[model samples]
Target: MTLDRRTFLGTAAVATLAAPMVRAQGKPKVVVIGGGAGGATAARYIAKDSDGAIDVTLVEPTRKYYTCFFSNLYIGGFRDLASIGHTYGTLASDYGINVVHDWAVGVDRDAMTVTLTGGDTLPYDKLILSPGIDFVDGAVPGWDITAQNAMPHAYKAGSQSELLKAQVEAMPEGGLYAMVAPPNPYRCPPGPYERISMVAHVLKQTNPSAKILIVDPKQSFSKQALFEEGWQKHYGGMVERIGPDFGGANVSVNPDEMTVDIDGAVEKVDVCNVIPAMKAGRIAELAGVTDGNWAPVNASDMSTKADPDVYVLGDASAQGDMPKSGFSANSQAKVCANAVRGALTGSRVFPAKYANTCWSLIDENDGVKVGATYEATPDKIAKVDGFISQTGEDADLRKATYEESVGWYAGITADMFG
Candidate 1:
């Protein structure tokens, strides 16, 4: 069940091993759960490359998928909510993919079937699970999913994004906006910080007296220096960050009272964005592929260590050295799709190569990025090279970085849905 680089690359030899064919024409079936960056891209690639040789079905509950990558920009008024939303119609018409809008409730490994909440079961020769994330219970005391309305995480985007923005706008003058940041290994390391900057931008323009506070568990964060510099330059005296050195780790929120308890000290806030500890989406656990938290996946093909027939991608997977970003998921999906297609058919499987870049916008036309290229090794996905934006960079380079992110957003969405 443990697939090393050699075993994963040799998947073609096992192409003819799948049995109990479901289709009358003997076409192999692939059931993909979750329709975000990883799942959408994987389903698209497999269907596009197979050319009617395989049956690909993608199961996602949402009709219009709102990407988390640019949701921050939406909050900052740089982009509208509609600009970040996408539909699967083009993925269905152009690519010949079956996009099912429903929840995948269970997985039957022995029978090779996936059960939906609607009482229909889909049989598959290969299964891909890319469910993004769910917050851990009790990670933030006195806070849970039920309190999301009061303390909007807005981590998942869409309605939550709308709710959080509305709350920020409704805050009283000189009111405090607090954010309880997540721990290490969470999705989008710089995401919460970028959101802070966006919120700062809004407050500076509207409620100039409003204060922004970040309660972080980690000692350091991604692009820390860049974000700090931007905060000081753009919204001086409006932003504050408290790391673990100042009791940021021991924190809890009272949604009813709209107060935060940091190390036994209570501070009342107008709006609280509690991004608690996270794990693979519930479906991943229900599928019985997770190692308590995240599903361990092979570096070469993204197949889970629990079962080679099942693959985990994006935020649900625990592949070494790759931050869970939209770009990471897109990169992992291509590698997975290629390997899956090669395993189901006699198609050529290329060597696995992966890369990810996470871009964060501090203010208008001020962007920073961190990324690395990876290779499949016997141990894990090894980082080959990396880069990041430096402090004190000229405005032109920063603006160009922001523009590059704009182009990438269009390119990736087109690549996913088309």
Candidate 2:
């Protein structure tokens, strides 16, 4: 039998299982929705450290999980799609977690249970909701989920990424490539810019005469100067960014016509990537944990402000001072795991300290990053200190930064899946 990476990891770990199964004895139950960074890490830590004291179950609809981190590299031709795909086998067999591949359609807070789309009710003592994000309805005029096939967001990081890559690769020489950037507080502050950089890289080599336009609703963006510098250095005279003051505010896309309307000015494009405004995923809304667009959580332990037993993490969470990046989600998961275990078993819970680093690849072996360490405060997660890639960094330092990102990807995926 040819065991894949996931199968091998699961089988190897299970062969040496030492922890006893205590689920039949009615241990404290923890159910985590969404098997992304937050939910996967939380479930694994809760089950692994509990020593059969907790029954951990993770519910995610997808069989294969793709990390949004480094997905831009896939589009940039720096990575293969399979390199970023992960499986839940380790979480199930190795960590003694009940991995349920089903959508959690509703949460019955009063009943202390979650309702699955298949008509099953899962009772839990504590619930962790990390259902990522969902685009707002009609956030982009003439564009919605239905139009995704034509104007790809590629934010979800799978086939969409491949689609966008194909669209860009197929553009004719001297063609136009346009991107509609999202508003504030979306996932990955530096994401759209990094994508633009990657797109420009591909175009620079394939069709130098092609043009790339970024229509941004905000006047400024994360690591703006650094990206602008990189754009100028690597793909000069090919990229243009229009801020809100310049008609970026009023934008509409016609997927059928491959047209973009910016404040009554229309432009036709060869390729369009429309990233609409987003909020917490539908499961979070169904769980009744969201305030406006995001779920508000206590800074101390990521517990939802609505219900203490329920917690929210990752892009769905509005915890302050942390960008909605995979690193942030993974960091929050560890903290939440510790808190949940302490609440269940009287374990010592330390004060919550979190950190996140968002790295973007501007070109081959060239990267930029922004990061900070955070501490939980009475109101929110406040930044203690932060740092960013300075503009005009030397080539060696940029190469090192890009290498560090490669190492981080390997380490983080191992930490999450294994």
Candidate 3:
């Protein structure tokens, strides 16, 4: 159940072995579930800062991850998949962290162990759960895994991204592409809008006559004015947005007929991207770490209210005022890592300052960003000062911002897994 650094590294060839092993000396066993933005960064930071004081094991099924941050560029044909995809080999070889390719099935709080899908249980002194978000099934009728094959939601930023791109490429010049945006408190508030913009950018190039319809459950969205301005100036008459007043045009899709019903009206589209309601990843729910859909955590440490030794971060945790984005996840990871280290080492935990910046691309050459920093209060997350891109900014500035966003992606990916 317990794996030491040497045994774990040595058993790389026979990872399936379940032999009993002696525990390492002067090290706290830390098992991190999920290897996306939050889990990867937390594992690397803990391994680096702990300095042989803690054993870090990262449990994730995927060896490589395609980030959602700049995936819009991929949709717009501005970037290749290789540019966004990252591997965990660097985290293993360079950071001295045990990277386990396994899905966490359950958590036994009484035994302080995590059960894997392979029927193996790994004991840990502390656990970090950053399993991210999972789409809510039945949130939209007639839309499930099978339905997603035709109408892809590239929210996970991998195969789904490729599928959505393929649909866009195959669409006729005058075809319609429909995207249904989820309600607030979901992963990546501006993400759905950014996706629409990117799709429009592609349409401008390949299918100039193509039209985009955005169906949203909410009245307003993050960076609404900026997105609207960019859409009007660049893709006018091609893009249309319908809010709740327009009949709650956000819910339900019929993937078979490629039709989506908004309120009472039915609209046919060439392609549909349904971003359904979301919840913390399945493992969090299995472990009883979530209330309804989100894991309740202390903002200062991101430790779950239900469990003291387990911390949840990223989209899985209820981080008030922090939109579920890669920037926020990475920021939360660092804070949680420090808190876990302090708790294990009997050191004082300092007040945490969290920051996030989300960049949305209107075109390959144009981008807008919204950023903010916050301190956790008793009731809610209060934002500090930050600014969106200035309205009607010069074209050159927008181009510069797009380039800056690419750099940010590279830097953050390196910070997370490198």
Candidate 4:
């Protein structure tokens, strides 16, 4: 069997036994929804490991998948939009997997079929939902998807990232830039903070006098100390944050007016980045698997608690301890692929292990990271060990950390698409 660099790294750690699969009449069908880190990786791994033993179909609307991870760097001018975009051509041409570019509008659990917006229904023995996240209604009063353009979230990457960057560049001299950070359990714990660093980097070079204001509901956040230290050192007095004590939790926005009302104090700003409360994508709720917000899954295999044949990965799954990150989704995909393949093709199933790392760039050649190792227990995916960059790290170490993230991005994309 052949494996790519990312594939080898994920599978080399696992020990398995190859058991002969018992084929009844035809191959078992596997249908996967979404094409981001989790779904794409799962589709690739299942097709590769099964070696034509299972029929895999990937359902996603976009031809090119844009990563939410590292998008802040793009906003900060570290990378172009093209570098983070990936397509499914290789998965279709090389893996012999059927790729359907359509929105999965419905899922019938009793009939075990998926309905697409194109008026087509696909039958499947097993289904994988990795549709990422969607904002909750009334998450932020006076803001909805219609207001996305004026107050762009840029959380899903792609065009939103581009729009946010363009808006930042077009800001007037000494303009105020505000960000309403999301609450906990959102995609990428440090994402909003990382974005702040990126925005500050751009403002420093272009509009030196422009200031950034953060309206955060949480009292503390991931890598708070590291981010605060970097902000003071690199862009001192240019950034201010209002935590819950300052009524950051109570916020509303008027996209037309370009104003943020925090705790009844209205602040006019040139640009507003609103990241509201989030939940699993709509498809998970449609499939009857989600427990209100996220799908609960078995830690050992990532199978949804609602149904044995349905598996949810990435930001959509309530897997304990792991932050919702691109690296985390990719990690969960491999474990899920192993279990799904074993169930269908009678292949070797190994115990589940997961890992994730989130790297953020504070300034030129300055990077910080947080990560952990997880193992499956009877209850959830429990954290075993973890590591994070310290507050006063040397410049050389920070640069090395940034470079490591670049390499990981290249490798993980290959593992997902190919």
Give the winner by lDDT: 4
The regions of model 1 sitting more than 4 angstroms off are 1-25
Ranked candidates, highest lDDT first: 4, 1, 2, 3
| Model 4: per-residue Cα lDDT over 156-222, one tens digit each | 9899999999999999999999999999889999999999999999999999999999999999999
Q: Candidate 2 on 1-418: residue-level lDDT in tens?
A: 2223454234223111234433455688999999998999888888887876898999999999988998999999999999999999988889999999999999999999999999989999899999999999998999989999899999998999999999999999999999999998899999999999999999988988999999999989999999999999999999999999999989999999999999999999999999999999999998888986999999999999999999999999988889999989989998999888888876767788898888999999889899999999999999999999999889999988987788777777887888
* Backbone clash count for every predicted candidate, in the order shown: 0, 0, 0, 0
The Cα error of candidate 2 at residue 298, in Å, is 0.3
lDDT of 3 by residue, 224-292 (tens): 999999999989899998888887644677777888888868998999998888999999998888998
Q: lDDT of all predictions, in order shown?
A: 0.90, 0.90, 0.84, 0.92
Find the 10 residues in a row with the least total lDDT in model 2: 8-17
- TM-scores for the candidates: 0.94, 0.94, 0.92, 0.97
State the lDDT at 330 in candidate 1. 86
TM-score of candidate 4 to 2 decimals: 0.97
- lDDT: the better of candidates 3 and 4: 4
- What are the per-residue Cα lDDT tens digits for candidate 1 across 289-408? 998889999999999999999999999999999999998998899899988988878677778889888999999999999989999998788899999999999999998899888877
lDDT (Cα) of model 3: 0.84
